[model samples]
Target: MIYNIYFDEANKIDQPGKANSYYGAYGGSEQTMTDITQTIQRMYEELGTKSELHFREYNHDQHLKKYFKVLHYIINQDVNINILIVNNTEAHSIAEQLNLTMMELRNLFYIKIPERLFYGVTRHLHGQLDVNIQIDRNDEYDALGLHSKIKEQMNAHSVYRSKRYKIASVVSEESHESIPLQIIDTFMGIVVFLMEQSYMADSNTTLIKSDLVYRFLSEGGNVERFIKQIKLYSWNGNENLSELSVGNYISQFMVYKARYDVSEIAKLQAIMLKNPGLLAKEYRNLMEYPNTLTRMLLGYKDEVEGRGRNYLLFQ
Candidate 1:
């Protein structure tokens, strides 16, 4: 079988002190690509939107339904997603400890992060599949240069050392021209957002963000069941990368309910009465407020409807 991997990055690429950086690669067979594109086209038609589906551009409550549908389509399809998360502050500390230059650190990140993510995906192939990787075009690295670096790393890895597994090509392409790249871009957005929320010390923000992600996935199918099909790999300036299960993350978040201030609870009640969708909008608004109560209320509603936990404590 021929497998194509589409790659993209989220957040500042070379900046050292930033909180988070993510590189994601998602792809499947050619047939799966066709199926995904067709489904996305149908969604656009239904929504009367002719514009391309870019996660950053369309992240809002009004577009939440379509976003959920797109996610559902990707999850139900044969595509695989792998994300490499970098804690830049930690990475910088490690670089300084190792006496590495900023350029050396950046190059290491660009090369190793994607290489590890790709290795994780390719290692499972067992030399049975031919792979072609296409990365989204970026000014930071030339196409030929990146292709060479990736090819060299793949060759060094034990997983691709077999004669039977052939890397057909590794090239960069304009994201606007490829549906799979766009799809991966959208997925990366969610991945980055969820990772950021995972680090938040505020229990309410963490719980709300987790529930929002759960609801988004639940729209397509059973979130628990669907999570088994996806893989998440996290790196935080450690010698080894760790794997996280979406199901377990959701379960952990669901069990914890932080006490909300009485005034905040009242605000949430008023917001729910006026427009429940507004809560979703607020969740998407990364700029202004934490809006932890909105997520708590949503989780409570889900519990009441028997879609999630059986009981949630407001206090």
Candidate 2:
């Protein structure tokens, strides 16, 4: 679906008695979702430059809001669109805000909002003109003016339980890339932070090789940065590829190659298989981290190959 909304309910800040106490019942989509895959590739290239390194500490809230706005802008501008809402228990109010008939909205998208608002907001937002107003839940604001049916649904819940709504779903759907982009963004942030603070190195040696390889595979296995970063790091006569931790460098490269379809990624994978010594002991030791995206990359490559896409990876 063009619109894949994640709506959270009872996320109110001060409402400990209510649902979603800390996060505040927020529902929204990111603009980048439509182009997330491409954006990840672009981010891969942009991370190569020192000037773009600040993305390490980039503000997540601001980026998410910006994407949300972008998505809304697109929906308002495009006609005959499809949308899905991941239903949240408390946000029947949003249904009233979007102006889509409940059935029409559900048919085009997946709804996950709490079921209480399902029918109420469905009726409220339908045929409404003001689609951009911000909504809030508090003593003075009862913005939704929800229908009795919704109220009855909420009352049906246990005293300690909150209400829920299930937005409808359509048989046909358009997949977007927001989730993938967010994943890539998170990794890029870590890479940038490591590089910016020089934590990328163990002692004297820098992470230039790993970072460069990260950028290379991030761009779908392009080897241009691989050559450039190696050359740059080796500028001093004493430094060379052999001096860097083989395991770390290879792991970094595998991460990028796993995400994209590149020509020689399999060749590079083969290199890792034939010469495990290319990565140093200490580098391999870091695999102790809780989640290994590098492993995921390997898995992704396997899946791609299974789909009959020309692929290669060292065992």
Candidate 3:
């Protein structure tokens, strides 16, 4: 069967920081992709929109229902997404200590990240898995000449190595032309944002973006399923790449509770929608806000429904 792979990257591609760079390839079988693309195309056509669908272009006022349906459709489909996180902050120091140039280290990642992503998806299946790849082009990979290396590396792995995934072709395409690319592009943006911005010490996210994020989390059970499809591959400089250390392991993406804290997110939005006036004009100790608000919301819930839903806290 033919597998369609749409590749996209998010975060600071070559920058140094926590959750800095992410390389992702997301898609499913050709038939699956075609049906999804046509469905999304009809959504846009129904709204008289002649533009690309992207998380970056997400607007709470304009595109809420559109994006909601998009996410809903994606969750109900069979898809796989793998993201490799390069903690350049750790990698830079690791490279420096090992006396290796960043270029050399980056070259290995270019070859291995996508290789690992392919391994992740194809490991379970068997027989002739012909893969077609379309990448959302970026300058960082462009400098590395990844255009050719991507196909070369994947085919080389499948041809000689026991890797079962084979690449038929790799091409660069605009998200506007392909709905699957746009879908990958959207979720790729979300994964990177949740990892990078929430981890930033002093970052204050825009309310509109957070609104979209809350809506993204509004998927409920689908959120967990969506999270499962995205796995993060990491090689923080803690491991010696030259030594090829056995201690190294690539894991899936994880986020702290502040943003992905779905319970608090739901409560906050519910409160904001129900009665914005009950909120304080200013708080002296902002650190005390969550607990204080939780108490208030619980009290309000009890008053309205005649019982406290303390059980939801465990979930």
Best by lDDT: 1
Error of 2 at 292 (Å): 4.1
lDDT of 2 by residue, 1-315 (tens): 112222222223232333211111112222434454344445445434221222233332213223322222322321111111122223334445777554444332222223322222222222212111122222222323322323344334322343232322211111122333233233333333332333335521223223223432433333332222221111111222112222354455455434543533454455456556444332223332122233323433444346322132211
How far residue 114's Cα lies from its native spot in candidate 1, in Å, is 1.4
In order, candidate lDDTs are: 0.65, 0.30, 0.62
Question: What TM-scores do the predictions have?
Answer: 0.72, 0.20, 0.69
Residue-by-residue lDDT tens digits, candidate 3, 58-141: 533345456766777786789887777777777677778889887787776676677666656556656788888887766656
Tell me the lDDT of model 3 at 254.
27
State in Å the error of residue 15, model 3.
Answer: 2.3
Worst 10 residues of 2 by lDDT: 230-239
lDDT score, candidate 3, position 79: 89
Model 3: ten consecutive residues of lowest lDDT: 243-252
Q: Give the 10-residue window scoring lowest on summed lDDT in candidate 1.
A: 253-262
